[model samples]
Target chain A: MIDTIGFDGDDTLWHNESLFSMTQERFRALLAHAADPDDLDRRLLDAERANLKVYGYGIKGFVLSMIESAISVTDGRVPARDLQSLIDFGKAMLEHPVELLPDIADVVEALSHRYRLILITKGDLFDQESKIARSGLAGRFDAVEIVSEKDSASYRRVLERHSVAPDRFVMVGNSVRSDILPVLAIGGHAVHIPYAITWAHEEAEPPDEHYRRIDSVLDLPPLLAAW
Target chain B: MIDTIGFDGDDTLWHNESLFSMTQERFRALLAHAADPDDLDRRLLDAERANLKVYGYGIKGFVLSMIESAISVTDGRVPARDLQSLIDFGKAMLEHPVELLPDIADVVEALSHRYRLILITKGDLFDQESKIARSGLAGRFDAVEIVSEKDSASYRRVLERHSVAPDRFVMVGNSVRSDILPVLAIGGHAVHIPYAITWAHEEAEPPDEHYRRIDSVLDLPPLLAAW
Candidate 1:
């Protein structure tokens, strides 16, 4: 029996990827005057991959990558005003209101009675904390772990701290790379709830295994009940 | 007698503020073409205070503030090449090698046998982790807590988890605001080690208090040995 359920914060519980997409749209528009839109898009993604080694993920990292790519694609002529626009775009993202995914509250509320609900997210500590606190759902979770990254090792360590056996823990989230694969690797159960928009960096190949996938988080309760 | 000791990561144990100062100098240079240095400096400080409300502390927040101030000071004419320079400056700050403060290792070792040593730091998750892993001093601490912020309540919670009473705890660090005041307010002991270059934002009006303030971490051993 699953005694604990972990929820991924960003795209999984709320409309996070939408914010990133909106910002990316603004970034592409700002850099459009200097380079082909498709080329600029590709370069920005490449810069993100390179900067991830140095900057990690989240709005801070995303802003830096946008600035770096703008400079390179424009050969350092991207203009200060445009860079400022990018910075403003990022600030808006940081200040954006937390919007829960459809039926997330009802689903989480139903699951809470059967198993302990925990929030496992990785990002800027303050941003994630602010989002959770503002979500007004902070009191629902039994625990919250804001981490640097989520992998099998991180999941195992978290479960170990809760004195939970791997099989007794289940993770539910949007990203296969972050939410699904890691939990499954640790002998834990998982339900993949696909967000309407998933970050490209989080996409991964399908593993030769079985795990339940749902169109939204609202479907989570009935699946867990069956398990 | 203090039974558990906590060390603040950034300036207390290593050379952290120096990197920030160097980066600020570079930021000043990068924006010099578009605005008066003194005026730009004041504006940047203002931007930092404004952004702190939304970004919190850390190298990432600092970079965003720098970019925002650059845009505002230059009236959005800061130039993309200069913006790229700013991004590189931040990357340098993140990648800079960790340099231990004078006698930090020996001091922590002497105190460890007498009291449980813990590291409490707040900043970008990956950057802090990178510095700690490379510091080669990770094993000296009994535990590490990378938190969102260090406040009275945070200290109280951490102490409770460690099964420690606030009165039995002692925190040592460089900033009076972050390192000294809150811990003292929580009925815990604090030792303020004044770094040569404390960030202006971390400065607070001198409070009436009896907590010890040492010139350096090297001075901590003898002071603690007597206690």
Candidate 2:
């Protein structure tokens, strides 16, 4: 029986990818002289793939890649007149603020009674903490963790910290990687809540057994209530 | 002077609150005997306030609160027959899928060439990553961070990791707390991208000095280009 529940942040609880899409379109228009949107995307993807190790995950790295892609695709011909626009674009992205997924608070409130909840997240600590505080749901968690990465090891640590046995804990989130895969690796049950937009860097192979996929976080309470 | 950019996820990227509104309507129907929709909402909010420490952020917690509220409002007289429907509602939430904010990807690509791009996000790793991957903009970012929270410390780490000075960085998002306040705290610039539905959890005190606010992310490129 599941007694404790762990959740993923980002798309599971709020909106995320659409912002990137907006930025991507703007980038394509700026580079129209050098390449088509498809071509620009391919080049940008290539750059991101090459830089993942150095940049890790987040906007700082992506902005750099956009710069790098512009330089590479344009063969250094992207006019200086447009260079500041690129920088301005990066600045624009940085200034973007956060918004939550629909009905997230309502759902969280509904689920709190039955489960010992833990928020298992990965990212820069300061940013994570600020979001938690702002999220208003911060007060609901028994524990909140900010990790550099989400892997099998991380999942084990979280379970250990909560004294939760794999069979008694269920991981609920949107990613097949950080949420489903890692928990499953530790013999924990997992529920996959697929999101609309997925970051390339966070992509992983499909889930195996011990992992169940869902469309939203609201589904967990009923599943657990029965368990 | 900013050379890099970041974006917040959630309402900024898609349609979210409407789903919760829909679910609330359904839930109110189930508990029509207990209280009116507004009363139910108020009670749920009260319960949410009380349980924030136990459930943390997201739909899992909200659903729990809804269940709790249902039980409370009904004075524990919630019909057993209706219990199944409540559970089904929770399940339905889980099955609900993500739908991207309109024109998001194209805009991001358009802006990518003119700026250094990054996706600065806070939440569960899997959920955030899933949204990024599914959004088809996975290849666009130089970095993708699934942060635990958003605060000054998180922003500092992001800056340090990228070896970029705060003066050269800019933050973009829809939340005043996570995206705007923290960036400003660190002497970095920020732009407030407001969305239609702001999660109560992510809402913060209104605008103050040291920040700029905008109606949408679409206005960013032009605004920044002029900057």
Candidate 3:
């Protein structure tokens, strides 16, 4: 019997990557003269991947990487004005209001009454905290963890801190790389709820038979009930 | 009665503000042609204060504010190269090695064996985590909290989560605004160990007769013993 449920914040509960996608479009347009669209995307991703250890994940890092990529792809010719636009993009993304996925509010509220709900996310500390506050679902969570990354060790640490045994916990998230695989590795059950958009870095292969997958968080209640 | 002790990172455990001070010197040199030193400092601080809500605290936010300030101070004519250099400044600060304050490692290690030690510092999560790991004192900390801000409310929440009462808790750190006042506000004991350099934003008038003021964390063990 699972007494605790871990929920991923970004694409799992609300609209997140979509904001990044929209900004990337703006970013590409701002630097259209410097590089081709596909090339720009590749360079931006490469910069993000390279800087992950240094900058970590978040709008701040994304904006920094975009600025860095713009300079590299343009051979230092990208205008300071364009770089300012990238900074503005970060500000807008950080201020963007949180939008909950379909029926997620009701689902979370119902589940919160039964299980200890933890909203686990990976990103800039301020960005994640603001989103949680704006999500209007903050009251439902018994705990909130804004980690820098999600892996087996991170999962184990979080569980240990909460005094929850792995076998009695269930993680519900959108990214298989972050939410599903790591939890399963730690002997916790995970429910994969595919989101409409996934960041390239979060893409991963689906696990076979070990965990369940649902198209949306709306289906989570019935699935948990049956289990 | 104190069974738990919370230690602040940054300048309290290692060199932090000095790195920023050195980077600011480089930044000033980079934009020397555009503005006066005093004026530039004011502009950067203004930008930082304005962006604090959106950007929070960290090297990434600091770098972004620097770029913004440079553009404003230069009337949007700050060169792309200068902006790139600012980004490099952030990267360097993040990758910089951790230097524990004088006798901090031994002080923390000694305290850890007697009391539950929680490294509670506010800033970018990833950056703080890296600094903790590099400090070679991570094992001494029973818990680590990388919060966005340190306040009475945040302190109350952290202690409650750890099942520690404020009366039985003592926080040691460099900033009175962050480490001393807030913890004391929540009925907890706080030790203020002033760092040589304090960020302007972290400056506050010293409190009278409420908390202990030590020259350094080197003085911590003896003070606690007397208490």
| TM of each candidate vs. truth | 0.92, 0.50, 0.96
Single out the weakest 10-residue window by summed lDDT for candidate 1 chain A.
A201-210
lDDT by residue for model 1 (A1-227), tens = 77889999998888888898899888877776888778988998999999887887788888888888888888877777777778889989999999998888888888778789889998878889889998888888988888888999989988886788978888888888888888888888877887776555666545534378888676778778777
Off by over 4 Å in 2: A1-227, B80-84, B198-210
Ranking by lDDT: 3, 1, 2
Output the TM-score of candidate 2.
Answer: 0.50
Q: How accurate locally, in lDDT, is each candidate? A: 0.83, 0.70, 0.89
Q: How many clashes (backbone N, Cα, C below 3 Å) per candidate?
A: 1, 131, 0
The root-mean-square deviation over C-alpha atoms between each candidate and the true structure, in angstroms, is 2.5, 23.0, 1.8
Candidate 3 regions with alpha-carbon error over 4 angstroms: A198-209, B199-210
Model 3, global lDDT: 0.89
At residue B34, give the lDDT of candidate 1: 76
lDDT of 3 by residue, B174-198 (tens): 8888899888888899888888985
Task: Please write out the lDDT profile of model 2 over residues B5-85, one tens digit for every residue.
Answer: 877766666555677778888888888877888899899889778755433444444555676677668765664335435
Docking class of 3: medium
Error of 2 at A175 (Å): 21
* DockQ of candidate 1 compared with the true complex: 0.71
Model 1 residue A35 distance off true place after TM-score fit, in angstroms = 2.6
- Compared with the real two-chain complex, what DockQ does model 3 have? 0.80
Better model by DockQ, 1 or 3?
A: 3
In model 1, which residue pairs have backbone atoms overlapping below 3 Å? A80-B79
